[model samples]
Every structure is written in structure tokens, then in C-alpha cells.
Target: MKKIIAFLILTQSIISCSNSDDSADDNQISGGKYYAVGSTYGKNKDNNFTQLASVWIDGVPTILSNTASSSVANAVTFYNNDTYIVGTESLNNGNAILKIWKNNTGESLTDGNHTVEATDLTVNEGNVYISGNEFIGTLNSSIATIWKNGQAIRLSDKTSEANAIYVYNNDVYATGYKIIDDKKTAIVWKNGVETVLTSEQDDLESIATDIYVDANAIYVTGYLRNSFKSKAILWKNNSPATLSDENDFSQANALFVHNTDVYVVGCHIDTHQYDFVGKIWKNGTLVKEINGANPKSIIIKNNKIYTAGSGLDEKGMNDEGKIWESNLNNLDFIAKYKFPNNKVNAVLVK
Candidate 1:
């Protein structure tokens, strides 16, 4: 079955945005210093591959960790004026490990025995919450996990993984996919209690990519997949709704909920299979489509929509990391930024 796995960690650049102007009108875009996360890649002097986990402050990259093998910076969060980023690094010995960096210095969280995925993260109440999976216990099946303050907690009983995590009222809510009855099913774990969000029937697979919680409801977004098509899905209060067409390849990467409306951002591959179209869905309806590249993360603040990752230029030639500011009402572009790399995995606002 097809899967729409949208995880943020760097393939290229970083992003950040301070609070926007309070008087710019609900539909206007305004911002201060912005921060983002992603990875930049190149060849080392030995012609070995190299990927640097990095964070961008004011659009300038600060390398987190450099390895001649490979390292990626995927998710970033700004807390107490410090930068926190998480990703993976492949060792020369062939073990992939998770790396978490704070203000450029780093911490290696694993023993490099099993493959680890550092998909997304959040800094809450002086503790770090990271969602991903690790392969262990002989069969090497992926096991869903959460690392809180560097301590591992299991969230699944079988082959599964978590894509996103959010903490509200001292409770942890995480989402991803689990192998249920031989089908990949979307799941939500509330403080480690299992709650299957997507149907176990009518489809071969599903993934829950991102989640948001407010005072009244829990909103989760991802995609549902079958043999031929992948459609975006939104789960609010355990009720599921399709956000994209059922006839195409589409996935919701992230979402933000405000008042009575929900904003979802994702990507769909074009029919030709060469180009990716970014998409925005509001309240289960498609409202905008961004051409040139895929977007991985989104935030709705001050009536402005902030989403960033890597995208090609207007000429469709140069690949660059970019953060776009758009009007939340009309979904019109207001500002755009281009960085030096080709694959940016994530964007976050301060």
C-alpha cells in the first residue's frame, strides 16, 4: 500500500519567525526574526557524503553536527532563547543514531546498536519530547517510541511509529501508524493509551502525521492510502474527514486549529510524477495549492499562515529552502524567502 510519510528534519535549511505585528490586520503578514530547521548536504574532502544538521537564525545557518557520513537536522523548537533540534546521524560503523542539539552543542541519545528515527520534537516545561521509532528485539520491526528527557517510552505493541507529539495540560498525545490486523492503521496514543483513529477497513493503510489539541477538541491530520490512491485525512474528536481527493496521491503533513477553523498543509505529487504540489485545506476543503515543491510543516498565527521547507524557484530549476508568509483569509502569498539548499525538512515559529 502507498504511504504518505511527512517527517521534518533537515535535507537543507532552517526557519524561525517571531511574533508578527499586532496591528497588521487579520489578513496581513508581518514578522520579526524567524527560525527554522533542516539539513544541508555536500561531499567531504575525501569525497564521502556529508550532511550537516543545522538551524537558521535570521536566515543564517548554524551547523549543529557535521559528519562525513551523514547527519540531518529535522525538527526545531525555540525555548527560553535557546535552539533545540533533533535528527539522525549515520555512523561509519553503519549504525544510525539520534542526535539532539541545543544551541549548537549536541547530545547523542542512543548506543548506535539499532536504527533510530528522530522525526519530530517539542520542548515543553523544560523537558524534551521526541517522537519516532527504533528497530530492535531481533526481528527488527519498527517500534513506536517517545523520548522524554532522554528516557524512552514504548507506545505500540507491534510494528509501528509515531510522527508527531503534542503536550497539553501535562498530558502527552502522539500519533503515527501501527500495523493492525496486517494493515497499517493510523493511531493516537494519549499518554501511552492506544486509540485507533482511522478505520481498519475500507483501506489498506493510513498514517497520522501531525496533531493539535485545544481546550475543546483534539485534531489530527495525515493521509489514508489504498492500492492506487492516497488521500489526506483529518481526525477531530475521533471523527475522521477526508481533506483531499480520493483519486490522487496526497498527504497532510501538519495542521493548526484556531477558533472554529482548522488549517492543514500537505503535498500531492502531480500526475506526471515529476513535480510536487503543496496544498492547504481549510475545514476539510481544499483552498490552495502551491507549486514547485513539497511543504512539510505549517503554523497559523496572527491570521497568517507560516509553512516552510524546500521548494524550487519560479523557473523550476534551483532548489532552495524557503519560508512563505501568506494571508490566512484569501491564502494569497505575502512574502517568500529563499535559502541556499535544496532540501529543507521543517519550519517552526517562535
Candidate 2:
């Protein structure tokens, strides 16, 4: 189930323009200068990895942790006027969970009791919403769920899952897939109602991987499978737009919209094997590749774009995690560290 997928999911990182060395001197307008939020890992063989929520200011690292433990933070969002950083902590226990830290106060909103694991979180109008799967029976069944103020709101009563979540105009949107008759169907949930964004036509699996919200639009990004390959897709208001040009396997994991422009990051696999090349698309146009990049989360702040993800090494382990700043007009690795092959799920500015 999701537990298996969570272990296999590649981990990913982040760096903002102000925090990047190359753009450290760039005189650009920003939101009074905020720091990027993400995690860091030590080594794969270590008993546990430190799930870090960091703040980078002028290319310096500021660590934020409520408690000292080896937890993996999947996503982070700054809301309620940047007073809180909401994300999930993979406890290494059977149950991973959704927790919030109030601006480096070392205080958690969860109260450190329940093991409710959250993946993606957002703050809207003083309200907090997080998306991820919750364990049904001591890590037995993971139900697709959303939590509002630490209260569970189940999306699928059965063995279903929801991963990424966003809030717009007082409405919540989440995406993942469901198991129906032993087949997976791509789905989106809005205020507890499920909508099938893609069908299980001909054993072609489609997953609604990421969700982005704007003033008048909602963008969903993922992949649509076929007999030969899986193509990257972006859904704007439920309308589909294919991104990949070649007949290769391309999947999008992160999405963002700014100033009426769309931005997405993911990987495109080579025809031979699991060798995925990192890809970033702007407004459905192919921009560039990271050569062997695998992006996990993307964000837009201060009129700049930032991405956090990892890439494969010669040993085939996803060890190198990178962060890029777009407004600086440079796509260079801001930070790189060694860890197990993990996936970075979210990014934010604090």
C-alpha cells in the first residue's frame, strides 16, 4: 500500500534565490526576504534521518525542529501570516503523521500524541488543511484523508489514499488514487467529494499527483499511461494538456501557477530503463532538463520559482538533492547532500 510506496519514494531539497550563492548578490524585489522551507538527511545507513525544516537567509542554514528525532518532512507551507510551518513528520514508527511547528517556538500543534501523518499542507484564511493517508489499524490500512486543525476528515472510507493538497477560496482540493475492484483510478477530492480525474481505461494507470490553485483556476499534474509509455499531463480546470513530446515515460510530481503562467517539474524516463531525466515545463513548453533530475516539489514566491528534488548517481541511488532559483534566471544546484534514495514532497517560503 502507501507504506510500501512511501519507503520507495525518492527523497528530494530546496534553496531560494536569496539563499543561493549565485543569486545572493542579485538585487531583486522579494517579500521582505523570506527563507525557503525544506528537509535534510544525514546518511542512509543511519538508524533514522533528521526531518529538517530549514530557513536559508543570505546563503546560511537555519534549522527548525520542535523535537530532536529522525523524521522525514514531506511538505511545508507557511500560512497564518508566516507564524507557522505546517508539514508531516515520518516517525519511522508504523504511523507517520501531520504536525505543525509554530515559527521555531519548538512547540507543535499536534501536541505530539497521535501518529496522524500528513503529506501536503496549506494555510487559507487562518485555517490549516493537510493532506495524506491515515492509518486505519495500527498501520494496517491507510485511508485517504484530510485534516483540518488536527481533526481527521476521511476522503475514502475504504483502502484509498490522497497525497497532495491545496486551498483556494475556502475550498480544499486533494489528489491521489483509489482502489476499485482491484484497479487504481486517479481521483481528486473537493470538500469531501471525490472526482475521477482519469479513468482506468485499458489498464492505463493515471495518477493525480499534484494540485495547484490560482485566482480562477485549479491545475492538476500527473501522468497518463498507455500501452507503450506514460505521458505527463496537466489538467487545467479539469481539461487535459499533454506535456511530453516523445514516446517516453514522463510523470509530473509538482505544480505551481504564477502571474497566469504554469510551472511543473518531474522526470522523463529513458526508453531503456528507469533512467529518468529531470524536466521542467513552463506553460506547457519544455524548458530544460537536469540531465538525470527527479524533481519532487515546486513553488513560486517573490516572483521567483523554486524546485526541490533529487537525481540518480552512478550507483543508482537517488543521493543528490538539489534546489533551484528561477527568477535569478539560473538553474544551478543550490544545495546538495547525501541521504537514502528519498523523495522531497513539498516546498515553501518562510
Each prediction's TM-score against the native?
A: 0.86, 0.76
Give stretches of model 2 more than 4 Å off.
1-34, 42-59, 62-69, 89-93, 106-115, 226-228, 270-274, 312-318, 328-345
Candidate 2: Cα lDDT at 244: 84
- TM-score attained by model 1: 0.86
TM-score winner: 1
Q: What tens-digit string does per-residue lDDT give for candidate 2 at 173-273? A: 78877877665567889888988874424477677778866566767877776546777888888777889875767777777666567777878766555
User: How many clashes (backbone N, Cα, C below 3 Å) per candidate?
Assistant: 18, 15
lDDT string, candidate 1, 167-186, tens digits: 77778888888888898788
RMSD of 1: 5.4
